[model samples]
Every structure is written in structure tokens, then in C-alpha cells.
Target: MTRDAGQMPEELERAQRFAWDMESLYGDDLVSVVLYGSAARGEYRRGASDLNVMVLVRELTPAALRRAGQRARDWVAQGNPTPLMLSHDEWLRSADVFAIEVADMREAYHVLAGADPFAGITVDPADLRLQCEKELKGKQILLREQYLLFAGEPAELGGLLVRSFSTFLVLFRTVLRLSGEAGVRDAEEVVLKVAARAGFNPGALLEVHRARASGQPPRPTADSPLAVGYLDAVDRVVTYVDRLVREGGAQA
Candidate 1:
């Protein structure tokens, strides 16, 4: 099917071209190409956000995978995340366990080619909440272990902070959604909204977002109170979600 790029931004137009390139390689085997994450949601910052793409194929056989793998390398080399390759069958079956991912993509996405896989899809709230909690705590543990390894290095710590904070912001939206508040799509605004709802001071996290967006090193050192405050903010967020889970129960 012919796709239109007339309404999209230059970055997204480029994404559509990449999608068409995949179609050229896979032909009838290509099921769909979609643009998701911040870019599709209209919150993308050219240098700060990734242009996430999902390419669905009729089958992911070895030969097809090899062809797609070549495009994946070139895509990343051009600064986009590797396009997520999933067979059409797997896309239908995986949503039960990957509820949060499906829900997030379904919440906002643009179909660049083929059929819209996310159309009419539904994600179980309980499953999404469970994964959100699991991922949140898992990342928290990773932060502690990694922090020990980079304890005093300002640059390394800053880089870690920049990369890791974005995940929490993504998870934060799900946490808020569990409580029936998913209207906001901007990650920074999501953090502020969650902070007010959960009663944590959003200042430290705001600083982290600022640092990440500016591509600047976090001003505070590993030994500084601000670093400690960042962790404290994470802890508060985790704890708040835990309470919401227990109080609202899994289905809520």
C-alpha cells in the first residue's frame, strides 16, 4: 500500500523512507512498519529522543532476519534505535506478557506502512502494572550495583544518570496510569504530575531531566546531596507505586 509522509516531520519522513526500504527488501513478507515512542506521540526532541520503529514481517526466517539485520545496523549507525523486528504471529501472541510495551505503543503510534497492528488492541492493566513494578525495582537494583562500580567518577555517574532516568520516566507513566491518570504524554510533565500525585518533591528529578536533555553533566558529584536526593526520589516513586499496587489490587 502507498503511504503518505505529507503530514509528518522530516525525521518521521526519514523513518517512513526507512520503512519503505524494508518493504523493498522483504516485499510481500513485510507485514507492517510503525513509528512509536516519543516521536509518534509528538513529544520528540530531535537530538534528545529516539525515533522508535517496529517492523513486522510475515515470518522471521533466517534469510529474512539476515536481510533485516543489515538495515538494523545502518539504522543505528544513523542514530535511531534498532528497529524492532517481530513476526506477525509473535506480535499477536506476545501482548499478554508484554502488556506495558503494547499499551505504551497503543497509547500513541503512527502506522508508516502496511496494516495497523495496534488497532483494536487491548492490554490488561494488571499485567502492565506487574511488569512496571518488576522493571522499576529491577532498574533500582541495577542502579545500586552500577553506582558502586562508578562511585566517584563524575562523568561516568552523569552518563549513567542521563541514560537511566529516561526508563524511570517511562515507567512512571504506567504507574500513574494504574491510578487512572495517563493523560499527559510528555515525560517531564509526567514526572511532575506523578510527583504531585505521590507527594514527592520533583526538583531533583527535574534537574536530572534538564541535565539529560542539555547533554550536560549532572552538576552534583557522586558525594553531593543532589545525587543522594535523586536516589531518594526514585525510592519514593517505587514505594508510592508499591502502595498503589497493594491498595488498588492487581486488576485496578
Candidate 2:
């Protein structure tokens, strides 16, 4: 498809050009070029967010990597992340492991070239829930470590929150899905719903988001740690996921 519902013209054109380039470089070896992440989600910020692309191929080789290295470098130099290259067999086999990412892209992606690899795909709910809990806890650990290291610098502490907010949003979306709240993609709506469901104050999270959007470090909300409320919010989410009934199959 040449267009996605909410994409801006420039973004769409760039994605199409990248797809065309990949096709021209790899020919039939390239299975598909999919646009996902924030850009594909209609949450793109021209100067800030990444335009995440995933290229699926019949086989991934050193030769293939060498061929696309320059183009990938140019793309990253333009402020986007390096394009993700995966083999078709790997894509199918790893769905059980990368369920969170696969399912998100499956739900929100645009197929810029070839066939839609996610068509008819269904992620295992047990895998999704397990990953949800694992990633939530893992992120909580990462945040604590960040806090311990940067506690002295309030602005850097705030920067940690701003940098990590987007990642937390992705995690929150997966948790909501496991909790039976699917299809809530709006940023503020996701925050509100997650706060309601997880029983955390959304204030700190929203503040972090505002700081991120405004391109500034968040102000200290509490005296000591500066991000006390923010850390507490993440902790609550970890605890909430702990109590969740591990759901799977049809009901999940």
C-alpha cells in the first residue's frame, strides 16, 4: 500500500523510498519492508522520534549486511535508528519470544513492500504475558540503577525519566493487552488507563511525558530522589503485573 491512514506525506514518501531502495538492492531476496514503531503508529515527531523499519529477507548473510551497510548508515545519520533486518524463518520462529514487539507491529504496521508478514499471525498470550512481566520488572531494575548512578544531578535524573518514558509506554501497552485492554494506542489515554488499572498516580509519568515533549529535563517532583513518584509508579506496575493471573489461549 502506498499510504497509511495517519502518516504525513513526507514520512510516507521517505518510507516508500527506503522500501524501494531495499527492493532494488535485494530483489527477490527481500521479503518485505515494514514501517512500525512511533512513525507507523502516527505518533511521529519529525525532530525527535524514530522511523523504525523492519526488513525481512529470505536469508541474512554477511554479504547481505555488507550490501545494505551504507544505506543503513545514511538512514541512521538522518536521525532514525538503523533498520532491523531479519530472516523470514527467524521471524516465524521467534514470534514466541518477541511477542510484544511482533504483536505491536502486527497491530500497527504499514507494509511498504512485498507481502504483509504479519497477516494471519496470532501471538501466544502466555508468551506475551510472560514477556510483559519480565520486561516490566527488568525496566524497573534498569531505572533503579539509573537513579542510583544519577541521583546527585537532578536534571540528569529527570533526563533519565524523559528518555525512558517512551520505552515505558511500550511496556504499558503490552501489560494492558495482557489485562484485556487492547487497542488503546493514544499516548495520554494509555497513561491514564494504565494508571487506573495499575493503581499508580499518573502525575509523575505525565510530568515526565510533558518534559519529553517539551524537550526539557523534568523538574523535581519530590525532595530527595527527584523521581520518587516516578520510581514508585514503575514499582507499582511491577507489583500489579505480579498479581495478574497468567493468562493464555482463547481467554487471554
Candidate 3:
């Protein structure tokens, strides 16, 4: 089963145990087990973060899936998200379509067992751009819709900002990569850089993060400048990415 903590050591131990379990369970069929996302990047927060793992097997059959289902439930029961299960062939085949997530995995990951699964795989640049444009535009629409529902609800508005903040950072990093930029992983730094690039102030985004770190959830008033800035920053990122010179870049 999975377990999380207010600290890091024990969490790492849990990941290690998971790796050992998978190695034993699948043996040679197990291509690799990797710990990725915030946990692998050293940015995991005790109560807010999840331990994301990637598992690759030689092949995926009904029997393999059945086995995974059994172990996935065990892992999820312990408060961890289900591991990303992929077959070696599927991993290579779906590279382009899944580039955005694979990009993050390449950015930071700890190999638990076997060799790195991404070692020789390639993600098409065109596919990455297509996904980014699609995702940003979709999120922009969702934000507008969510704002309507939360417009008069201060606490909920703040919670929306608090919740989606990290997700935007990941999007921002991928956007920056699209612009040939790299090496800025800190949340504050990423916000500031992306805001400047996409033409928005970082104040509101920074404020939401501060509130979360203070151990008190921020409840920004519906019309508060912080709330307005939060929406504007994301809106501008959508616009900026849409204007990039690539196929499907400008979605009307």
C-alpha cells in the first residue's frame, strides 16, 4: 500500500519499497519503474503532493492488466495515485501523443529499477506543440467557466486559484520549452518568467502560493485584485501560446 508524510525520508522509502515490489512481481517483464513529477523533482509538499510513478512492462495483455489492477488497488488504498502503466511497445508508439507528460518525466525522474525507459524514445516536436496549444486553450475556457460559477464565492475562488496554481506552473514550463528556454523550476521564478513572457503580473499568482505555504488556505474576495490577477495571468498564457509559430498554433 501507499503512504505519504509531512517529511521526505519515509516517503522516499515507500517509493523504494514500491520499486522493489514491482521488480519482484513482474521480474523480466518489468521494463522499469520510475518516480517522477514533484516527488522526483524534490518539490513535493506533504499534504498537497502525490507520489507519481511510471511502470513499463515488456507487453500488456489481459493477464498483465489483471495483475496491475490488483496491485494498483493496493497502492491507491494507501493514498497514492495509481502508477502510469505502459508496455514497452506502447511507450514507444505513444511518445508523440503523450509528449507533454513525457517532457516532464524527462525533466526529472528517479529510476527505481532497471534502466531508463525513455532512453531511446523520441517525442515529435509538432505533437508537443499541438498538445500545448490544445491544452492551454481548453484550460482557458474551463477557467472562464469556473470563474462564472465561483464569481460570487470568495473562498471557492481562492481555492480555485490555490488548486490550479501548480498545474499552471507545469504548463508554463512546457511553454517555456516551446520558446527554447530552460532551467527555471522554482514556482515563484516560473510564475514571474512566464508572466513576463505571456504579458501578466506575477503578484496574484505569488500571493496564492504564499497563502498555501502559510498553512492557511487563501480566501480571496471575488473582486479582489489578487483574484482578478490570477485569472488574467492564465488567460494571457493561453493567448501567448496560441500565437506561437507552429501548426495548430492559432485556434480560432
Candidate 1, residues 67-99, lDDT tens digits: the string is 877778999999988889999999998777987
Better of 1 and 3 by TM-score: 1
lDDT score for residue 196 of model 1: 83
27-73 per-residue lDDT for model 2 (tens digits): 99999999998888788776657789999999999998888999998
Instruction: Output the lDDT of residue 119, model 2.
Output: 71
C-alpha TM-score for every candidate: 0.91, 0.92, 0.90
CA RMSD of all predictions:
2.1, 2.7, 4.0
TM-score order of candidates, top first? 2, 1, 3
lDDT of 3 by residue, 143-213 (tens): 77888899888888877877787777788888887777755677788888888889999999899887776
Pitting candidate 1 against candidate 3, the one with the higher lDDT is 1
lDDT of each: 0.82, 0.82, 0.80
On the 0 to 100 scale, the lDDT of residue 166 in model 1 is: 72
Q: Which candidate leads the pack in lDDT?
A: 2
Record all residue pairs in model 1 with backbone atoms less than 3 Å apart, i.e. clashing: none
In model 3, the runs with Cα more than 4 Å from the true position are 1-8, 246-252
